[model samples]
Target: MKLPSEFIEKMERLLEDEASRFFSTYHEEKANGLRFNPLKIDRETFLTLVPFALSPVPFCPTGFYYDAHEQPGKHPYHAAGLYYIQEPSAMFVAEVLKPNPGEFVLDLCAAPGGKTTQLAAMMKNQGLIIANEIHPKRVKALSENIERFGITNALVTNETPEKLAKYFPGFFDKILVDAPCSGEGMFRKDEEAVQFWSQAHVEQCAIKQRHILDCAYEMLKEGGILVYSTCTFSPEENEQTIEAFLQTYDDLELLSIEKVHGIQPGRREWTNTNFEEMERTARLWPHSLKGEGHFVAKIKKTGPSPSWNGRYAKPNASKQMVREYRQFEQEVLQTEIEKPMYAFQHHLFALPDHCPNFDGLKVVRAGLHLGEAKKQRFEPNHALALSLKPQDVRYSLDLSSDSVECLKYLRGETIQTGEDRGWLLVTVDGYPLGWGKEVKGMVKNFYPKGLRIN
Candidate 1:
């Protein structure tokens, strides 16, 4: 990979004797880290379910390190939505964001939904989470993952941060801008990333990062926290971008990140700029930590705002769509689940509030995900399906290990269950996997395909 002339010169001065070594070699260590999905199972239960071969990550309480020989994905617990595979450094941003239940949060660049899912788990599926991704292709993957993880509080939106800002000015209590950047940090994992590295690309990404941060700032309420993060190591995309943003928005102030054991803070000085006081901003170097390169900075919007003429315009769903959704909810899940569920757009969602305003923002999903009703029985959806308690349903299937594995892996035509007839909530060690109906000594599978263990 060819570094920009200016960047190379800067690295030469910064590294001095070690500059050549920094450029010549890449860190190739692969560490497996998994984030526990609190919505489906508690931390203790998740750890107990993990195979003994995978070691626990020492620094982060929720993160675990898997051995090279282990296939963590094949485990039944994985299909049960017990945890998610994530790089250790990538998990830090969500931990620092620390979203609470019943708060409105936004993930401006959410796709594949790692952090967004974590936010939902943290919120206990109670509050509103707007997971926005501008790219259309990635939205499918994001939506599937959210369903697989049984996240009910999330609403996916496909729109740029600029457009989103116009719809939701100061609407969110917490906003996370995991901005897109030149793949500097991912170069070790992906060789092609290094080939695309150039001065122009870095500068271009830095500009986009600034725009994303600006949108995040505009949408966050006063006293709200906005976390800006990237998977790149370049100062231009990291510290400098943040420094520029702080200079532009007086209402925003850099807040300190309480240090974790393995993570180090960002450099105090970069090029001509000094960030000594911005020690709260963190940088996880692949060389220094068990994971790949990443940067995180938490900033709080302070004081009163200049009242912009922006208001949230509620989304008007057609009466026909609403009526159909209500009937579907009433027939399938209204009695089966105790939570308040409603329909927004074409999707049904369950929230703490009776009626939520779905306005200018494009809402991909709205109410509690009651499984689609087929025949005379109601099937449970993957969303909030795993979180159901045993007594909440009329029937449940208890299957053997092989049957459970086959059902989880989506490889079985029929599952043997003790229940002769009636709908049964399938489970592994008391954690609800999903719902299944038993007929003639066989359990009908309802596990969503995207969520099925592969």
Candidate 2:
């Protein structure tokens, strides 16, 4: 890996004794970690199912580390949305943010929806969470993950962070800026990232990080919290960039995150620059810990800012889209699903009331996603579909040894649950397995084909 002269020079000046060790070798193995979704399953139950080689990550109660001998993805638990594959250090940012129920939040660069789903689980499917990913291609994965985890209170949007600030100024109670950075920290996991390593790349990433932070700050309401995080380990992109932002905006003060486990506070002094006051910021080193490198800082907006002056307009959806959504709710859901699903920039959503307030702001998502309703019946969304409790349904399978294993494995094959015919909810000791319509003494499988275990 070729380090930039300026970055290398900066590192030498910053770490007079440690400079040689910093850039000499590359650790090329991927860190192993997973985050549990508390919304669908409890910690104790999940731990019992994991392989012994995989141990709980001490820093995060919900996170775990496993040996690479087996593919966790191939496990039935993965198909159940029991956990998410994530870099261990990256897990801390969302935990530190601590988004509660009934608070408006944004994940500026949410994709593959790891942190976004974590935030949703923390919020307990209550409160509004807008997950914005700029790339259109990544939205599918983001949307699918949200559904897989049974999230009922998120609005997934495809837009840049700047566009979000324009539509919602002083709107969210909390915002997460997991900014895109040069893949320095990801070198171990992605060889392509190493191939692109250069001083020019680092400098370019620093510029983008600063821009992203600026936009995150603008979208935060007075007294709102903004959590800035990155997967890279560059002062230019981490401490230095934050210091520059502080100089420009005195109202944005750094707050300590001492409560989180598995993290050390940021260095009070970097290079020749001493920052005794900035210790509130946090940094995670892969070498120091069991995970990859990461940086997280919590900032609070103090003082009033000008009201957001952007034009507000209801999201316009094709009549066909609206009809499809409603028809599915009426027929398939059977229950009266919520209405006037929030719309934003050509998208429409329905969320439970537990979601946070969207009044006086541009709503990017609204309502519990009930999947798309169509043809007088509803097609269950992976989100709502995953949370269906067998007890909620009129018909269900009896708790048997084979039944339990089958459900746990997420096998597509149907089983006798003692139901004669009609819709039946499958369960393992009373957990929901979406819905299945039964006929001729057998239930038609409603488990999503893509989500079934191998």
Candidate 3:
């Protein structure tokens, strides 16, 4: 738990009288939190269903604080897209830039999808949200979380902010740049942040954040909201960076963020010119709250922007593939997929509403992946199963959360259903777990291999 000597010195200078309280928090156990998915279950039901003792995160209604000893990540409900484990302070970032249903949104630098999932849930999975990450490897985790959340309206991509800006100029109604930082706020949660702490690194992160913000501003339409956030408490990357950004763009205006539940305002004294309007931004200090540190700033674009002329994605699935999928849908699903069907070779996907043509972008996941076309028949993807309710399918095998059968299913073991139902949805406490295919009194597990628990 030893902090960098230079970082300690810097914080002591920054906090002055309050430095003692801030340093003392490091000795205490870090707070843990998770937000229930409203897309799948309601707050009251989730409260009754989950076994862990939980308390509400004051800033976010769906967010809850769990004990450090609890492991909600290992639960079957987690795999069923019931909730997402996240940092309490991190949950507040999406609340600042809450996007409405049917609004086009962008989560620039979205990876491991903590904030993106929250935003999508707020939107009720109705809008088209582009979750973009620059790193190839990180984008995969982002896609998996999006899938696990059963989010059907997100277009997960692996592309640089610069490239995205060029293609989606003035296209988004709202944007979130949860820019990468020096990890000062995440030090308590991740020790690597403490090891990597340096004044030079903070300065470098500030430069990168500003550039990412510039790109995010380009994609946002006139009168659109752009929320910039970081996990670091460094003024160089928070107040000072926002000050420089506001100075650069005349049309940009800093909007006031409601400082509730021990949340503090951005320090104007931390800026180069003592920018008085810096108070509009918000800071979540570890000592002042029940979670790790974070900084958030919401801005509005007042200048006019060119209207986006991008083409909407077209349905490209062949008649044969469609017929096979339709047959599978009729025999298996009680409900039908009415969205535009898109094909990627043998695989098929149900494109999101008003999905744009992602011709050149490195799309990791395009909306809801329907399934794959195999020979004369169609096989459903695990994503398709997770996206459905038990009532949506004809047959299902419901298993209790703590039962050995649930563990067996999660471990990719075949279950003895003793029913000849061709396709069945597997569930844990009435929530869709994954897909299973039945032949003669035996259900072959279709749970994804990579996700199987050993």
On TM-score, the leading prediction is 3
- Scored by lDDT, the top model is 3
After superposing candidate 3 on the true structure, give the runs of residues whose Cα lies further than 4 Å from its correct spot: none
Stretches of candidate 1 off by over 4 Å are 1-13, 17-27, 306-340, 344-347, 351-356, 373-379, 400-409, 416-420, 450-454
Kindly provide the TM-score of model 2 when superposed on the true structure, using C-alpha atoms: 0.82
lDDT of each: 0.72, 0.71, 0.94
| Consecutive 10-residue window with the lowest summed lDDT within model 1 | 329-338
Error of 3 at 103 (Å): 0.3
| Predicted candidate 3 versus true structure: per-residue lDDT over 1-454, tens digit per residue | 9999999999999999999999999999998999999999999999999999999999999999999999999999999989999999999999999999999999998999999999999998797999999999999899999999999999999999999999999999999999999999888889988998899999999999999989988898999999999999899999999999999999999999999899999999999999999999999999999989899999999999878999999999999999999999999999998999999899999999999999999998999999999988999998999899899999999999999999999999999977898899999999999999998999999999999999
- Residues 370-390, model 2: lDDT tens digits: 555455544555555566554
Candidate 2: stretches off by over 4 Å: 1-29, 259-262, 268-273, 307-349, 352-367, 397-420, 426-434, 449-454
Worst 10 residues of 3 by lDDT: 184-193
lDDT of 3 at 165: 92
